[model samples]
Target: MDRHNVELNRERPLATPTDLASDAVRDIGAGLNGLLADVFALYLKTKNFHWHMSGPHFRDYHLLLDEHGSQIFEMTDEIAERGRKLGATSLRSIGHISRLQRILDNDSDFVSPEDMLSELRDDNKQLVAILRQLHEMTSSYNDHATTSVIENWIDEAERRSWFLFEMTRRSL
Candidate 1:
């Protein structure tokens, strides 16, 4: 049978168990959606920087951006999976991402190493802020799994942002 045509012969609707567990799941889903949006935006910006970055620190900055991009990409997948675990569909497309994300796009053609580092630092900081908010929401809902994931991601992002800032400062 076609997947779309295959239907379960059940008498009742499949209610989401998370609804009974608590409103925390719903709240966590919402926060995770927001966090996913931010992560996607940051991922794009990091890749852009990786491609366009130039200076005495070209090689180093490029490598750093690539690593950061990979981390953000992994976080995006984790957040999306969390959304699914909470009984909702994950928003994984560019349109969904653009609609939900709050981060502004950097459309400039060529970006200096300093500018790239600054942008990444700002993006990471913003991500950390969003993660912190999500952490509070998850904690309120008593969602330990989601809270722990958010905490780890927040710490990593913050550390990366601080390192980027320090590098920029030393370059000055």
Candidate 2:
């Protein structure tokens, strides 16, 4: 056999053991996985509110929810890519998200705007907390890039949650 062929045969698969190494990379990968789940949950919740929102503020709330959903969905893809870059598997499917997500599904049949806002606020707060925790872990592992990403995400989630809370409070 040609030497090149032999070398190719000896190469490890992208998903194999050789692709995995570095404690900092592993920490970033795990954090990215968890962050992906949270982003997916946030996307779904925003879409739910966008689809079902009613009352006097329906137009504004619908638009806001849709925007929020899009933002979260974009973040989901970014985090998944970050995971792959970290030499880890990215959670790309709904099944993977469900398995990894800490946030509970919102399955209410008839949801009030207030209820939706409250749920979103709670979920965002939870996401922010998780991201901050993950940031700490990643920082300990010297994964500065991943830590920075999570920190930005946490800030965005917290701001969105506060906005939603304020809107709901004004309505009350």
Candidate 3:
């Protein structure tokens, strides 16, 4: 490897100052970055289950996972762009995502259909709580732009959770 630009990273400040204090921008951006990473992880896991899912309800389960995964993936771009708008360089790679992500990754081992639905439901529920926490932080810092974006994300996440939970109640 060339091993160049090493010093650039060390010297790069988190974000350019805006209406919000530099500290506040950095803080809010960091929170968004973490949220973005978790959402990305969750999206991947949801897709994985979608692909690997088996059993009598395969079509319904697959479609549900696919839809939810798309929603989660959609959130990542907005979150990352918001971070960039704040001048923060968001996540750079999958390794970075993994480092900041809150969602757990599942291996290839077989999981029962119900187990998959339950796991995703719980994960989405956890994600909603995280979004609320970030929203509060953004509110406290008067980062209304971030807060506004978070509200929509929370709604999407909650919807995903609702769908997952509903999947659990009706069929095996």
Candidate 4:
């Protein structure tokens, strides 16, 4: 291929045709990629807590975290694919995810079970908020498909947060 063609190919790899305008593609792709990064971060953190879980509630908390981790991990592929379907490039590396992720990692040597549950609950709440924002943005751009998926994600995140909240509740 000629240099100009090569440059064009380099700019857009695996591009998919979409009705959305370039601005819509860029904006929605950015939102989806950032959401994907947060989902991956949350997934790893959930797994970390699950692996490190201990105490009288070990079995319950461990199982819960494992389930949550799986759910969070499941969102990554859909988010990335949605971005690609919008004719934009998806996240290409760990560094890209790290740069875009809003969710903070828990790197403590040890975190108490209660602290782990509480932290995860808060993170899920934050994820729900992010999903809501993305839903609004996508809807405004007339991207009904993306907004529809975000609605489901928002529900899932809220459910996870509710579960964590109940687990961490202290009877008085």
Candidate 5:
């Protein structure tokens, strides 16, 4: 079924219980939606960079972007599922994702490999910050499942950021 159909047929109060209050689940789901949007945006940007990447490091940059894009895309499903598990309707469409996303898009015809790497690194760092903020929220709510997922996400985002930093680094 489509998102609209799913929206019209949502399971209220959640089928499963985790002891979290309904309000808490709703609040956490809202936050996860934002993360979902950001992850989607970053995924697209990473794929765009993968497609447009060119220069001396063409092969290496292309492969790196592809890998990072895959990782980012992977998060979208988990984030959305988490929201659903929390008794939320979750994301509706690309428009919905676009509305919640914070990552700045680059529509330039050509962005240098280094710039692509740098932009993605910054975006990933922003995601890490978002995850950390959500981590605090989850902790407060005693949402250990959400906290566990966010911790893994933070590690992945940090790794992505670290890789980008290393690739763009210039020794003195």
Candidate 6:
């Protein structure tokens, strides 16, 4: 192969064969990778809060965060695999994830339990919006499998948000 051909090949490795067209693969892959990055960021933040939890609600808040963290982490593998199945390369490293992730990180030395729950609730709502957008795009391409998976994720995110919201709310 000529130098130009060699460089092109290196940059765009042969994609795994799939029914998705090149455009669909490109668009969906990019979307999935971005979502995956956000998921990782959120998972870590959830864990951080869980570890740092204190005060009267320590046990309850810690356990809630642990459960939320696990649920967030569970989506990472499926998201990456789905991208690969669509013939698109997924996130390769922490640096790559940092570059693509939209979710903000919390690095404070101390975040109150209420604040942690509130932030996570907002983040989960943000995730639901992203999932909804991806679902619409995937459906437009007739990618029913990806859309179905996203639907379940959307429901899960909403539930997480609901729990977080309730935890932070004042008793009436």
Every model: Cα RMSD to truth? 4.6, 3.5, 5.5, 2.8, 5.1, 3.5
Between prediction 1 and prediction 6, which has the larger lDDT? 6
Candidate 2 lDDT by residue in tens digits, 64-116:
89888887887977888777767677776889889888988888899998889
List pairs with backbone clashes in candidate 5.
none
Q: What is the TM-score of each candidate against the true structure?
A: 0.86, 0.86, 0.88, 0.92, 0.89, 0.91
Counting clashing residue pairs in each candidate, in order, gives 0, 0, 0, 0, 0, 0
Q: Tell me which residue pairs clash in candidate 1.
A: none
lDDT of 3 by residue, 71-167 (tens): 8888888898898887777899999998999989989589888999998999999999999999999999998889998899889888888888887
* Pairs of colliding residues, candidate 6: none
Clashing pairs in 2: none
Model 3: residue 79 alpha-carbon error in angstroms: 0.4
Screening candidate 4 with a backbone cut-off below 3 angstroms (N, C-alpha, C), the clashing residue pairs are: none
Q: Write the per-residue lDDT of candidate 6 for residues 18-114, one digit (tens) a residue.
A: 7888899999999999999999999999999999999998998899899999999999999999999888998989999999999999999999888
Worst 10 residues of 5 by lDDT: 8-17
lDDT of 1 by residue, 93-157 (tens): 88988998987789987777888888788888888888888888788777888889888998899
- Predictions in order: lDDT: 0.80, 0.81, 0.86, 0.92, 0.87, 0.92
> How high is the lDDT of residue 79 in model 4?
93
**Which residue runs of candidate 1 sit more than 4 Å off their true CA positions?**
1-16, 19-22, 170-172
Residue 12 C-alpha lDDT in model 2: 28
Q: Write the per-residue lDDT of candidate 5 for residues 1-172, one digit (tens) a residue.
A: 7886566457443444457898888789889999988898899999999998888889988998898888889888899898777776688999999898888788998887778889988999999999999999988999999999999999999999999989878720
lDDT of 4 by residue, 1-172 (tens): 7897677678876666688998999999999989999999999999999999999999999998999999999898899988988888889999998999999999999999999999999999999999999999999999999999999999999999999999888821
Estimate candidate 1's alpha-carbon lDDT, on a 0 to 1 scale. Answer: 0.80
Clashes of 1: 0
Candidate 6 backbone overlaps, count = 0
| Candidate No. with top TM-score | 4
Which should have the higher TM-score, number 2 or number 5? Answer: 5
